[model samples]
Target: MSGIEYHVSLVGNDSWEGTRSAPLRTISAAAEMALPGDVITVHEGTYRERINPPCGGESDDNRIVYQAAVGEKVEIKGSEIITNWEKVQGDVWKVILPNSFFKGFNPYANLIQGDWFTPKGRDHHTGAIYLNGNWLVEAAEFNDVIHHEGNTMLWFATVDEQNTMIWANFGNSNPNEELVEINVRQSVFYPKQSGINYITVRGFTMRHAATPWAPPTAEQVALIGTNWSKGWIIENNVISHSRCTGISLGKYGDEWDNAETTTEAYHRTIDRALGNGWNKEQIGHHIVRGNTISHCEMAGIAGSLGACFSVITENIIHDIHVQRSFTGEEMAAIKFHGAIDTLVSNNRIYRSVIGLWFDWMTQGTRVSRNLLYDNYTSDLFVEVNHGPFMVDHNLCLSTDSKDMLLNVSQGGAYVHNLFMGAVSILPDLGRSTPYLRAHSTEIAGHHTLECGDDRLYNNLVIAQKDQNGLSKYDSAAFPVFMDGNVFLNGAKPCIHETAPLEADWFDPSIKFVIEEDSVYLHLTCQMDWKNQKSRKLVTTELLDQTQISKLPYEDTDGKQFRLDTDYLGVARDESNPYPGPFEMIGEGRMVIKVWPHA
Candidate 1:
């Protein structure tokens, strides 16, 4: 049911009624008059301001919806245009403004310092300078811009008690004549308070936010953040150019923000979070789908304790933390701290530091059918998480020195994945991670990882010539169960495995090509594996119980699940199907188009 329809246009009045005939001048004006179940339509123009929704909807059925006008270009930017510039030296320009020009939050004065953030021996600020449509790199020293020698553009700023001075090396182009913009707001769309829920944001181009270092322990203000809310739908937007994170369905600020870095400190912080309404009834339950998030200095999508029971699917997340100006522990394309019962599926994540990093307390989480490649560190990193999480039908296809899938956690089930890289498994006896009860947010227990409580089945791993695979689990503390896995091109299997299909001398030369609008995977192999070993149809009943959590792998409703579908949602054969994610296979040249291409 529609409550009201408000329209916002460039040539409109704030005093007028927000109808299409007499539209409002600003989106903030429409937001002020919009009630629950209202619809706000923004017309074609660039809106340069931060949007802080005052209130949320009463329920998901009656949520406030904000959308761009159909087929119209709408851009919401957090930066303002700056035209005043004085040419100082060759390719160098300077701008000086009063400190009060930045209102209350000055990105130039704010340093990027938070929990799990390393400055790499230099001070990094939250400010950024953009020329035309690209962002310039920040210089570590004032003399680095003064004595600059190449074609690279750099920006250096210094803020004092009276004024803030900024210097830029704009090569060949006059800064006063071109479109030079600087960050003014910390977020484009975010709530100032927590528990703002049941809102829908869609179809806008949001960019150029001077966001902060979004560690899981902090509030994680990003280009767009849910801010510990519930029942939010953030979809069909283009978000980019954040100094830190692009999108955050993440934590809210606390007294312990940026103060918990150690293992013991984080564990205590978790306890405090549990006391402060970190359950599924209040926080999380967000849906982030069908958006393009890119060019953030930190993770593209980040959540601390606020990503539980959420669905993040079909998003293209790339170019996260690619600058390498700083290093931290919380860097990835998709980084979540607590991912309890979250459904992360069908996303294409590439060209980041790490593809996915599922940190502590990731029980009942389902990561399925995602395509990850070109990540420098690793494809997927499960750090210190406990048992009963599922990973299925994924293609971990990153190449070179970064082609390693790091599994530093236990109690995991890997099924029908295509690993085109190496694999590493190690136990963590130091930091004891939390594990929730089955399909619930109540933290049942916490224990140090004992290692090798995992089940690996029907995975096809293709390691490089000298790299290794599941054989890394041969030295673990407990015994692991493995069956019907195909190891090729020097990828090894554990000695205790039963019916391991080993093809050492065969090199199925694989190629991933992106042409026009689709991504295709080309590989050549033999078809003898159809009758080599009989495989069981993997189900929750077959995966009886995880050692640490002692829970069977089931859905959020406590129902059993079966792996009867391929990565493309094609139906699999009932009994004794193929071993890999694809069911139908041939002896030679098989080229399949991957879905949700970037």
Candidate 2:
């Protein structure tokens, strides 16, 4: 097929031929006419309607490209501008809109509800009010907006069957003079159907979406989503102010998503996914990079379709899931389920509920070279997965000892990481988690007991005062291998196997360097493992030998692990490499390419 370039402008007519001079009016109009190998260049304007593409491209090379024209500031908004307003006493203002203004869907009437969504005992709409490009807090009650003494607040109520009434506190500014908008749509750019493959959306600012909570058990919704699609490249975009999720590379669950209320619903959803083509040919080979996704209620990037054989790198994701009017198990900056053979690298994630959460069936996955700090919960939470996985070269710092790392499952190798907080490996024996077959996405079986066979190698751990650098629960029965790790500032890691045991003291003759803000330990003597020789120095070769032989760190279609270089594009040494992420450039020194707030 011959490639064609389509143009869209604010002043053009939709009936015109989408040429350089005769451009279309709406992105939706261009999307309706776009075919494979088509490029839709949207001009600089605030487009309000959602761009629901009818179809996508046939392959990656012939993708349907939707990009901002050159360096133009193109904004695709899920909101519509509202101008008519009346002062309703004090700082509160009111606006009444006819029912015809909403077309068919009303986001104000659609309450945010889904699996694990908490409305705080009041109905919270997906709709929001933005005053001069800044989003206002949505009030659950009318009294909270009108009677409250705060900076600003907004509330919406249905006025009979003909109109909708909205009240907001404008803080002395007249509503007529400000650019006020309200969320009227669910998504700015999203496909109405699934399997929309090989699409590229770039260089656009998407915001003010009324998205719902995205759980692996439900039909995940986002401001912009690749709904069970393949080969989508969402890059170089600024996505913000989503009511729930920002970007979703996820599945479309069935009616069970709305009916089932237990954990078995997720298992059933997985079963349904297998019946449908949830294999390498059908699901997840997406590349999401160079995007800044922030101020989302749930997550910056979330997927339930496992994101199998995908690459999510170099994205700046922050301020996610921070305001917790609602809480659940699936809240994080980047959360995914069944991330088989996927690479999550070189991303900066901070100031979120949890940083990176790899929940269930995370086999053959690697979390490497990421900078995570100032998260409320732990930076990394790997729950219920027996992995032959790797976490290396990450700089994980938290404000306190409670927010470092939480490893709930087993069979993980930690190498060359800087941990500036606490680490906990607690196994929940009452729950049995499922494991998938090696090299396949099919579930093999479930482990009835907690199998903790995690290995920590050459990591630099700096613990806070009066806190154990690394510790496990007392009742944990599995074995954890520890060797070549440096604990600074008189910090000792505790290991428990059938009984609790503190780490043996290092030789006092070895000179160590402890800085004011950081600690660098130079060990001249090995750890004193007198009677614990059987449990000490257990390498990655022992823990992951069987799984590695079977799986070999390959994607479903035999794509090898994509870690030839570190996060900063530095080449890694094949033989005798150093402990952490960076290869040492000189004697007694390593380079950290990406620093906090750099």
Candidate 3:
């Protein structure tokens, strides 16, 4: 098919030709008419409709592109502006909206309920109220909203079939004058069907989506979701204020998200997924990059299907999984399941429940060159994977001692990472987990339940005073290899022995000098005992030679990724590199890009 360009504007008519002079009114109209190799340039405006593309492009070279006009501000919202309001009581105002305004699916009537979703004993809606670009706190009941004076909380209820009543406290400001917007739609940009390939959405502000919890065993939804599609590029957008997830790259459930309540149910779901073409040719291979995703209740970017064989890079994801009354296993800034051959690098994740969580069948993945700090929970959590994965060149700085790393998997290699806190290893020794066949997406073998046989090489573990060091639950049958790692500030590097006991590798007489004004934590190693250097105490040999072959990191397209340099773009020595993420650049440390200024 021949390629064409379409245009959309706020003031244009829907029946007009989608040209630069006579643009379409709604993005939904443009989505219906866009074909392969077409470019739909939306002008500066606020559109309040979901753009569900009818179909995707045939190939990568002929993909459809939906982008904001160059240097223009385009906001596609899931909300509608409201102005009519009346004073109800002290610091409270009420507004009645017609039921016909919602069309068919009303988010105010939809309560947030799903598997692993906690409502804290009250019914919470996907509906939200925003006043002048700031979101108000959602109240459980109308009485709670009336009684609450601080934070400008709000409450809404569907009053019969004719109208919906909303009560909110504007905090001494007039509700009629302020810009009030209510969530009216479920998503801003999403395809209804699965396997929509080679679609690109860029440079738009998508907000106020009423999304649900995205579990791996169920159909996952988000503000912008791939919906079990392949070869999608969702980049350079500002996505925020989602009720559940911001960006979803997940699978569609077999039966309306009625899966994943139990282990047997999840296994059945996986079997159905395999039958429905869950391989490299059918699913995954998405690129989500350079996006600023924040203020989400569940996750910044989450997926069960879209995360596999994908690249998520250079994004700023923060303030996620915060202010939710519910708790679950799938809450993080960047959470993924079945992330085989994926790369998550050069991103800044902070102030969330967990920084980066890779759960269940995370084989052949790499987490490198990321700056993770100020997280409420741990920086990295690797759960339930007998990995052939690598985690290297990351600056994991946590304020609490127990918030650095949590490892529940075996066969992972931690190399050249700066661990500024403690580490916890909790392995389940009851049941074995499934592993896929080598170089294929089929389940083949099962690794025995153990957390040992892991490797930690050339890492700098800086533990402060009165902080806990590396600890494990119990000793495993296999040993955890530790080599060329530096322990500073009286930190003890402990490992499990076969006798169900802990063994410390460092001596008590080691001293460390802390530099206060340094950006990087500077520590000078000092040993009080004679002829006992810090490197002499730890063995530099490999505990298991077979595990070394698993360290070849590959990207989503099956290309090998080279780690020849450190985090600061410094070259490493061929024989012996430095301990931490930075290879010693003269005297001071080589500084990498920590925060994105663009």
Candidate 4:
């Protein structure tokens, strides 16, 4: 044979020849006997089993590849026992509980019978029977049940929560040495424990228990590696109705530690003092892409700390129904913390607290081409310490109180984004004295902008009427220049400073004193300046630039003429007919000369 091929058959109907007609008994036997580069093929049937790597065994050097038949279906199930009350005392039954525990269970009365612990093994759910931790029980058949025989409980024994399941090494907490991976593709892994890692699960259909103790407690598919394995990939899976995220990467270590003062302290604390915390020492370049995550309690995808350089793209994440008590932590469809070089693009995120949230410390991040619609808060929020960002060409639509698109206190280029349905305008400080200005604001809608320098161009924004024109508190000043823009409805658009004057200028003397939205010019003649009686002649024939005698006003220093008028709210100024900066157009009787003075 090209490589060691081990065949496993759960039905026991096949022969022992290890071929199509004959296969072995269980997957556990195939794993135990198979060497590196071995292919373990299992027949179609439900096999209830658990996989415990040889103690202190590092399987990194050994690659075990397992697959089912091309068109056949196979399911490996765990055991489940149906019981009314659980039999355990002082065992901390009321310990770490999900929100569901508080719903029906009473702390003072009635001892609850449930699987408070998950066992060590790769438990699979197939056909009618679902696995509950190495034990086979039908969950889709029976809603409430706890079945366990030959089951091993997997939990943290010490007072330290991070001290849960040790990886490959016996006592050493290094991630690379004890990396455990569970690869389940085109299969089901339900009712799993919290402490799982280095898992590559793709193209699988997973279902949750009707009444399990809690959701998958730990990271569903944790791709954790300490200075050893750098990353893992979980792509193209249909995950829904889990208590937690469809796929979780990295580790969220314990919050408290007393290792600094104790003689015998946990390694997690020692690592924390040494510039690492719990699973924080592990570095993973995890990629979760092209997955459909919906109907979850929290966001569709979430990354914490050690999750760096991960790209989440082209995923349709919708219907994230978060409760009011989700608090500050539960806000975005995709939430990232302490992440670097992360790119979130070509995704649709809608109807969440915030569409895409960048939290903690993020650098070298890019958020582009995302369609965020009808979110309750700001569609895109870059919070805390995040910098060197490039966000562009995203469409954000919202009726919420915050901006449709927004950036806060961070440095980046915000441009070419269409803001509709009451979006806030980005602050324009492009020409402020000293350093170049930055445009910081959350954006909703689709338009493209330059990367380093923030410039908004070619964006179509349909906004509700700003009844007050513009807010007075906004102090940033910009000259009103209309170009390449179209405004609809009978709405008025004005800049942040004082409102535009609605009245007309009457006197040439007042034109210079008062600021007009439009430029004004005052023209005068030599005859009018010398002879005071000729002032009326200049005012009446101001439309006739050819008729008025040309002379320089004192203010013009003998080169230009100034207009004059005081009786009525009108000004008449003479201009050069030979074409100066100002041109007077109109003729005799009904003549009206308009001057555009530069």
Candidate 5:
């Protein structure tokens, strides 16, 4: 049976019965009135309040769906406008507020501290100041705010026992005249309790949250998060301007939050989690799709062990950790720890620190059809994983990426991808990371990393002049499988390839540019390498079994996988396909739109 419908509008009262004509004033009130199978529709205009759903839906079929009304622009934010500012110095302004004004949790009083977070020789706060939707960089101290640099918008805050004081360099603008705001709340739409399941949040423009540093061992809450829940769908939203992570599908709160700093301590975290419902039925399985998440200080999406058996697809995530105000270990567009059987596909990630980071226990995970470009760091990073993982049909065209594929792990299959960057292979004999069983979260075994058993097949590499490619893997600890690969533009091949095709004399002129929400590739390429060396269609039999896990390259259900499809889902030739991500294309002076195709 269909459940009740609750309406929320800005001009409604909390005492009124929630109907279309008599809507409620707050979404939280509507959430309180809602139950399983209930639908809460928020009307247009901004709502400066937090939405904490007390309970959740029972199942996917009967979910508590909270959606913004169609054709109406709804904005949910965690900041408050402040017009009461006094001019302190030239281009600098100050605001003083009572300690009681923060409602018991003052962001100015809280430091941005957690395990693995680097403050860069100074302390930083969780609070932020914004002038007309743009954020100001937090200063390291009061002296930094006093001696403002040219054109740098900076803010500094100090909290005493009774009051909190803030100073900001407005950069030639009047803070009282303009729309200036400050961070007040920690998060916008986050459930306070763990194990909240089957909730759907969609179509709202959420912004300006004071989220903290989200470590793997902590109760990683963010601007929007599942909080160790299951089967949550966060879709079709514009989430931005977070002090840290934007969306967190991560671990729950316990005594171990920020307490487990070392690797051995983290293994104990995993062991305790395994005993307390860290399985397929209880955790992970969250779907974050079709959202534009940007301007977060930390990751766009972060998960420790709560992102398993999930699908992250069709999202546009960028500008994550781009400001570089500080340093940290966990900074990426999408960062996860144990991404077992997770499918990360069709996502566009760029302009971030790192694109995709599968940290540990990345077994049976599939990374396909993603467009990663112009990242500050590498496009992909796999650390300490004993994987049977697959990364295929991706456009990792980042000439600025020092190492496009930083595979510090082993047993990975890279197929049909176009790379415009270098590769790095490094062994990890320090930390013994775990690898899970096929399609399950149960820990099968653990070992230190071996930088070998990698398969680079049917791929194209166009590196910069004098840039290194797969030659770095020549001294790997174990043997690797390298075949059917073409290197161009001074790119080097591994010594292991029996018959490598190197075309340093020919310039492919590979470059991709964005125009009108489409990525266009411009190149002058050739197909002469096909006759020089035979290319085989990469399949499960060719990938075979990983050395450590002893599992074949297969789908999540243990079915044999096929590499018979290109990045655009075009059919690949079974006998002999072209060496790149494209099977069929023009040869000379080719300019084609290669992304966002139907």
Candidate 6:
């Protein structure tokens, strides 16, 4: 009683806290009484309630934190035994970012702060946490970890139908929205229903993907810069099993076409008032890294809304499949709609309709050191748009057809990559067809540079499917600098230096195993040239018959692999392991073990 400031025991019926044994009964009472630097300890138990408070003032620092005792452990748990209808309001909900947790909660009540429904199976229209200056880390305790097998489950009880969990609005059409910064980390956040901004979420896991809460005319998840939520960092998170995009940054408002154009076109339009629409000049800096996101119904990680000066690196994103239930468009993995000054590096993507699909935008992207494998349609699908991009040191593998690696126009640099795809082409397409230039440009008398200022060097292009083992396709105008590649049957230069290594695996039977106890695997292949590499890096392996493999391989220590297995997985490190040919490759490999079903 002398040193203890206050205590709240949900189990006790006492409303007063005069004695050490007679503590406050409710957490709400303890929060009101807590002053700055005051400690409020919650005993281990289940407290069913929804929590909301006003935004934090600058002068107030009376942080209400829920933590384990120095030697004793306490648990605040969600009730897993209740039905979705019964689990409403009581699963420990909060309005702002409060340091709280359930040490023993298995299926706690839904954490709603924004526009969401409640557990009574009613549309409660409440969000989980308001996320102002407050910081929230819904961490798992030793018991919770053991109960969940050591990973935070963003959403449980796989609803046979689709569902949404987290919804946010970054304030409509307010340029000053960037001033508000919110960081949501080390937890699992799901059901991001609408557009948001100025929020940085890292080391989190997301699931139960739903359609963007925009009009059918709006094809994107959310418009990023309508009200500039600048300085957003969506890094080191596992965003998976969603129906739409993994992460969409940098977009503007509605333009000419209303309905389908907005719903279907994930392009960056230049709003005259907004200064070149959604370019690097408008949006602030962004960093999206070390995430493993897959099973999206649409594109994996897309950047439209004119996101500028952004770096999307070291993420494992794939399995963007189109479902019949998805009545919209086919799914794409990594799309650069109207982005600029972007560096998309060190990612592994596979099993999607389109991988690295670039559309209309001024090009200044440095897309290098990525591994793309078995992209169902094409690995690099460039459209009518053009740029001054630098495509170097990437690996592309098992592209099913002859349309995998190419540009709609010859602009960006194509250097040092390993590309493997089908080689059989009919004269209907013709030999003079250019690989770097699109068919629309090739058929024209003399096409202007789609977006010139290009350079090519040290790139390897291989044809894994040609019976004659030819790497080069017959084209009228070959891409510049087609020197360092090798063809399978000595036909033309298709793939680069390690033609045999790529050709040997061209039949598509080789696989990199990621055992259940195996943590994660840093599977990298390097070519002979200065910065050359094999492109197709796939994460389709199944570990322990239950868990699936994705990308960014989490943190590594030499051969040890630590995947971003769950929502709260990505941890920062001082060094990077995969630095390129001249640099170190898989130097620090860490192992990650996940028992999802256990």
In model 6, state the lDDT of residue 411.
48
Give the backbone clash total of model 6: 79
RMSD of each: 1.4, 5.4, 4.9, 22.9, 1.3, 16.5
Tell me the lDDT of candidate 1.
Answer: 0.87
Model 5 lowest lDDT segment of ten: 525-534
Q: How many residue pairs clash in each candidate?
A: 1, 1, 0, 37, 0, 79
The estimated TM-scores of all candidates read 0.98, 0.88, 0.89, 0.46, 0.98, 0.50
Q: How far is candidate 1 from the true structure (C-alpha RMSD, Å)?
A: 1.4
lDDT of 3 by residue, 1-598 (tens): 4588999999888899999999999988998998889989999988888888887888878899999999999999999888989999888899888888888877888877766666778777888888887777777777877888566566656556788888888887887998988888898888888888889999999998888777878888899998888888988999999988999999885674753466556666667788888897878888899898998888999987467888899888988877766677788999998888888998888788899999877877889888888788899999878776778889888656265888888777787787777687776765566677544568866655467667676676766554555545236445676656666655566553222111234322222222441133333332221111222111223323324234333433445544568786778754556666766634322233345422
State model 3's lDDT: 0.75
Q: Model 5 misses residue 336 by how many Å?
A: 0.4
User: lDDT by residue for model 1 over 430-491, one digit each (tens)?
Assistant: 78778887877788888887688888888888878678878888897876888878888888
Cα shift from native, residue 362, model 5 (Å): 0.6
Residues 341-366 of candidate 2 have per-residue lDDT tens digits of 78898888878889999987888787
Candidate 6 segments whose C-alpha is farther than 4 A from its true place: 1-198, 213-219, 222-228, 252-268, 272-281, 322-330, 422-455, 467-479, 489-491, 494-598
- Of the candidates numbered 2 and 3, which has the greater TM-score value? 3
Instruction: Please list the residue runs of candidate 1 whose C-alpha ends up more than 4 Å from where it truly belongs after superposition.
Output: 401-403
| Count of backbone collisions in candidate 5 | 0
Write down the lDDT of every candidate, Cα atoms only. 0.87, 0.75, 0.75, 0.36, 0.89, 0.39
**Candidate 6 lDDT tens digits, 508-535:** 2223344652223232333322232432
Cα misplacement distance, residue 59 of candidate 5 (Å): 1.5
Q: What clash count does candidate 3 reach? A: 0
Residue 354, candidate 3: Cα error in Å is: 0.8
* Alpha carbon deviation, residue 536, candidate 5 (Å): 1.8
